[model samples]
Target: MPRYEYRCRSCGDTFELSRPMSESAAPAECPAGHADTVKLLSTVAVGGSSSAPAPSSGGGCCGGGCCG
Candidate 1:
């Protein structure tokens, strides 16, 4: 299940709901029983250690003066 954020225009309230992706676009009622609501764009945060090796400081042939 994915969580979605919504804002109620009637009461100016913000809420979140967890539902299937199939119903993500379905209308949601606010906790205050307001049907006039709109779904808000969600932001995702990703964090992790990269597996790729870092670039070498000793730049390649150019830095080694081999290109000249």
Candidate 2:
């Protein structure tokens, strides 16, 4: 089973569920009993080294931000 995050449009509530991969795309019922829920895009981080370099400051035009 994998953990999936869902957001309910009716009550504006967020929750998590553990279900089979085959049902990953299936609709989830909110804990508040709302059926109008959709799965949320989740962020996953994978790392094995504590000495990993920190993320850059994301400065300049290289990033989406302008270099103003």
Candidate 3:
């Protein structure tokens, strides 16, 4: 099962549900009992050990330091 996120339009509430992928697009009820809800695009992050190289501190065109 995968977790899906949703937001209620009627009450402006957000919630998550775990269900089968087949029903991933099914409608869900909000915690506040609102039926007018919409599924949200979720993001998944993949990370590794701290030993991995860190991102550039100044990622701008010439590195933020050069511009500054």
Candidate 4:
């Protein structure tokens, strides 16, 4: 299942929902009892990061530089 974040355009109410990947968009009213719920896609955390972190400077390869 995928989690979706929503924002209410009428009342500025923000909420989240968990559903399938193929599921549809927003439905009825928002949590603030408003009918202006807009689906925000930019901030959606769909998946995890793929890239790894850079190497550290502190290491023993530089002739005991790390302990210095």
Candidate 5:
């Protein structure tokens, strides 16, 4: 099952649900039984710094910031 993020407009509650990918969204009813709700796009993110040597700068480095 995949996780879907949801926000309750009625109670202003944010939550996550684990359901089948086909579920599409969770019930509008909030945990508190509020009917006004909406499914939200989760903003999951990953953070890391790659030290594997930066790729060569396009156009090659020159005395000016913009060089070709």
Candidate 6:
């Protein structure tokens, strides 16, 4: 389940709800029972290491000083 943030325009309240991604666009009722609400843009944080290899310090013409 993904969490979605919403803001209630009627009561000026912000809240979050956990639901399926398929119904993410569905309207949500605020905790104050306000029907006039709009979904907010949420930022997602992805955690993991990058697959790209690190730069080598002892390779290439630059490292070997062959260009000069």
Candidate with top lDDT is 1
Per-candidate TM vs. native? 0.65, 0.63, 0.62, 0.54, 0.57, 0.64
Task: Please say which candidate is ahead in TM-score: 2 or 4.
Answer: 2
Indicate the residue-level lDDT of 3 in model 3.
94
lDDT of 4 by residue, 1-68 (tens): 77777788887878887877666463746776888787777433544565666556554446546544
Instruction: Give the per-residue lDDT digits (tens) of candidate 5, residues 1-68.
Output: 77777788987998877888777654756788887878886555333555576656553456335565
**Residue-pair clashes per candidate:** 0, 0, 0, 0, 0, 0
Q: lDDT: which is higher, 2 or 5?
A: 2
Whose lDDT is higher: candidate 1's or candidate 3's? Answer: 1
RMSD of 5: 7.9
Q: State the lDDT of candidate 2 residue by residue for 1-68, as single tens digits.
A: 79999999999999999999899999899998999999987765344447756656885356736655
- Misplaced by over 4 Å in model 5 are 44-54, 57-68
Clashing pairs in 1: none
Ranking by lDDT: 1, 6, 2, 3, 5, 4
The CA lDDT at 21 in model 6 is: 93
Q: Whose lDDT is higher: candidate 4's or candidate 6's?
A: 6
Our model 3 lands, by Cα RMSD against the true structure, at: 8.8
Which regions of candidate 4 fall more than 4 Å away from where they truly are? 24-28, 42-53, 56-64
Using TM-score, give the best candidate's number. 1
Extract clashing residue pairs from model 2.
Answer: none
Candidate 4 residue pairs in backbone clash: none
Model 3 over residues 1-68: C-alpha lDDT tens digits?
Answer: 89999999998988999999999988899998889999988765233346656667778547767764
How many steric overlaps does candidate 2 have? Answer: 0
Backbone clashes in candidate 3 total 0
- Model 4's number of clashes is 0
